[model samples]
Every structure is written in C-alpha cells, then in structure tokens.
Target: MSETHTSPVVLDVWCELQCPDCHQALEDIRALRARYGDRLEIRLRHFPLEKHKHSYAAAQAAEEAAEQGKGWGYAEAVLARTADLASHGEKVLLEVARELGLDAEEIDTALIDGRHTLTVDADHAEGKAIGVTGTPTYVIGDERLDGGQGQEGLRERVEEIADRLLAQG
Candidate 1:
C-alpha cells in the first residue's frame, strides 16, 4: 500500500479523559514516546462521550487549564480519576490543577465561568473532521484504529507506517 500524505506519518489519538481504556492507551503511548522520541509525534485530541455527562465540562475545564500551560497535566489528572468526577465533583478538577502547581482559584473560576468552551468546541469539531466517533480512536496516518490495541500491536503498526514514511522521504 502507498502511504502518502502532506503531513508526517504521525499517530493521532482522539480520546476522552473519562474513559479508563483511553487512559490506559495513553499510558502505553507515553511509554512508546519515551522510547521512540521524535520518531513518532503522538497527537492527542478530545472526544468526550455523550453518555459521560461531565465529560464535556471537564474537557472545557482542561482547555482553560491549558491557558495556564497545564492542559496535559489537567488531562492526566482527569484520566487518572475517571471514577471520581461524580463523587468528587468540581473538587476533582480542582485537585488536578493543584497537583499541576496551578492557582486552584483561577482554574475554578475559569471552569465555573465556562471560559474554555470554545477551545473544547474546537477540539470536538476537529475530532469530527478526523472521523473520531469514540473515546479512544486512533489515526495512524490515513488509517484509523477503532479501538485501543496492545502496545506491541501499536508499536508494530507504527514501525510499519514509519518505515513507509521513511521510504517515501
């Protein structure tokens, strides 16, 4: 098969922080990134599920956190405590900000005021354009992986795609 595109042969993961499987998949990808370094550029996007009532809200909150240069940190906390959103409520999000060394009050204000709605909306639109229909869909170049596969499976696939990209170059 011919692997061709204007962009690099990168892996794009569209995930929801509320999904445990997505969290696991992201952990695996983080390890892979550490090992492979610049060979793979793993891009993360938001694909909050509709069933998770607080997911959109959380995504927006994370986006606001990003304004303070803590998006990934907030996302990590969200993924880590997927089960706590309901019981912990806004406290869970606040804890994430605190852990990331952010001003908790500022994050809370941003979340309450719905400051990052547009950023999250942009992520939603981008996810739709890329055919992201689930919490943890992956796009390997032009190929889409519907579910989170094992590390070996993902690595092998990435190697194949990287080989093709290298050949094209």
Candidate 2:
C-alpha cells in the first residue's frame, strides 16, 4: 500500500443511492470513517446507473438535503429507505424528510422544482473524471476499487491504506 504524506488520503466513493451494493458499501465506509476519523477525507460522488429509474432524483434529493444542512443525515435516511424508494420514490423521500424532522415544504419544493441539479451534475462529472464506471466504486488515495467487495476486503483495504499513510508521516 503506497501512501503520500504531503496530503491526507481521500476516499472518494462513487455510487448510486439505489444500488444494494452501494448501500452496503456505505455502511462499511461509515465504520471505517469513524475508526480512522480525520486521517482520511471521505467523499461521496453519485454514479447513478442507467438501469435504476429513480437514482437521479434520489441523488438530487440528497443534494437538496445538503442545502438544508442535513446532507449526511438525509443520506443515511435515503440509504435506510432504499426499499421504500424502490417501491415509491418521492413518497419515500417525503417520509424520510418527515422522519428526520426536515421542513417538508422546502424539500418538496426543492425536489419537485429540481433545485439541486448543479451539485448533482458536479458530482457526476467528478466521478467521471476519476474513472468510476460502476456503483460502489471507491478511490482510496490514488488507488481505485471499481466494484463491491466483502466487508473484510473493504476493511483490510482501507486499514492497509490508512497504515501506509500514517507510516509516511
């Protein structure tokens, strides 16, 4: 595991919100982030697959949540509500907003009026620049993992990279 000491390692995850693998990978990423804390910077970019019908809207909704100062919370809500979204996209998001105590009127306006397009587009472009071709893809420092892996695989990989970064210091 190679590491560059001059900069913090960036773990950029490129994934669509609707993907099951992406959802699971996020759980692992969250655990790793908690363990490593500020040793790594975790970035999440959207890579909505063509097959998933509601991913784009869902990504936009999360971006709207970011606008409301609840990006992370809204993200977790969306991930947790994936089944609900799969069945009822907008309805699920509204329910999530209510559950999280966000201003439903504002979220409804944002989502229905398409207010978060720029942010979502920027995320998409960034993912493209990093050569992310699939859901649950991760770029740890300069290295990339382009598909889902088991929890142990993810943990070991992240830890190995973290250790290398620390060593470089």
Q: List the candidates' TM-scores in order.
A: 0.80, 0.85
Model 1 ranges off by over 4 Å: 1-9, 148-152
Q: Best by TM-score, which number?
A: 2
* Alpha-carbon lDDT, every model: 0.75, 0.77
Candidate 2 local lDDT, 31-86, one digit each (tens): 88788788777776777777878888888877777777887678777877677788
- lDDT score, candidate 1, position 96: 80
The clash number for model 2 is: 0
lDDT of 2: 0.77
User: In model 2, which range of ten residues has the least summed lDDT?
Assistant: 146-155
Cα deviation in Å at residue 132, candidate 2? Answer: 1.1
Q: How many clashing residue pairs appear in each of the predictions shown?
A: 0, 0
